[model samples]
Target: MASFSEREQAFENKFKHDAELRFKIIMRRNKLVGLWAAGLLGHTGDKAEEYAKSAVESDFEKPGHDDVIAKLMADFQAAKQEMSEHRLLKQMEEMLDEAQRQITAE
Candidate 1:
């Protein structure tokens, strides 16, 4: 078995890496949200930032695209919306799984 300090250091490293990953995920999500809001609301740079903030703060009530995934893939060369949605969902799953692992490890 690893010594206490060794285990502690490993845990700290894992936590830090996970946090960095989460930060990147949030930043990426913010960009997508900003793009969507700006295009939809006719907002520009700073205004888009404001819209993004507001959207992030509130419950974003956009319609789910689950039903249209197959159509989107068939119609578009690149399944953009589907890929972004998948990334977002995967990040959420990873974060939740990481939390569970941490809880169990403790």
Candidate 2:
């Protein structure tokens, strides 16, 4: 019984750590996408980092990337920047991969 309890606790700890890592990856991915978008929109330096932070915050509106997509689409249109939805989605996917690698390395 004690051994079983210890195993269960270990599993719980691992689950929590994995969940935190996943969240960090998502946030990093968002920031990466934001930095890319900022470059396309002619923002640089501190402005670009601020835009990246906004991208991370945009995810809070809903579960999944819908909110981030909508925000990016609106921003692009407003800034008169030409960006296809397909391209944006692809960038996000690439960033996600990079983020996972970065988090795993850490």
Candidate 3:
């Protein structure tokens, strides 16, 4: 029984609320993920925070907001990629060390 303007107002309120909630979720999830990733990568607290910020900034939204969300997701992926690279480098170092030890033993 709501008029068109009333329906529009209701949607605006819901949209605002949903956006705020989504941002909070993004920030919290990004912080947790970044913390774990940073620990594995040996990043300092400041660097970890920066990484988390980028991650939170980069996330997907609903179809109407895909442009903004897509950009943010790209940023999140980049941070994750950086962390992945760090882990890979550490693993490579361990492998190289083992190889060197085996060669010396022979």
Itemize residue pairs with steric clashes in candidate 3: 58-72, 58-73, 59-73
At residue 17, give the lDDT of candidate 2: 94
Better of 1 and 2 by TM-score: 2
lDDT by residue for model 3 (1-106), tens: 4698899999999999878765554445445554555555566779977765654454444443233334434544765644344453454345445544544464
Q: Which candidate is the best by TM-score?
A: 2
Instruction: Give the poorly placed runs of model 2, Cα more than 4 Å off.
Output: none
TM-scores, one per candidate: 0.42, 0.96, 0.42
lDDT tens readout by residue for model 2, 45-103: 99999999999999999999989999998999999988889999999999999999998
Residue 92 local lDDT, model 2: 98
Provide the overall lDDT of each model, using Cα atoms, as 2-decimal numbers: 0.50, 0.96, 0.53
List model 1 lDDT by residue over 1-106, tens digit each.
5699899999999999888875555444544544453554567888877755654433333333232333223323242333345654554455446545554464
Query: Model 3: what TM-score?
Result: 0.42
Clashing pairs in 2: none
Candidate scoring better on TM-score of 2 and 3: 2
What shift in Å separates residue 18 of candidate 3 from its native position after superposition?
Answer: 0.8
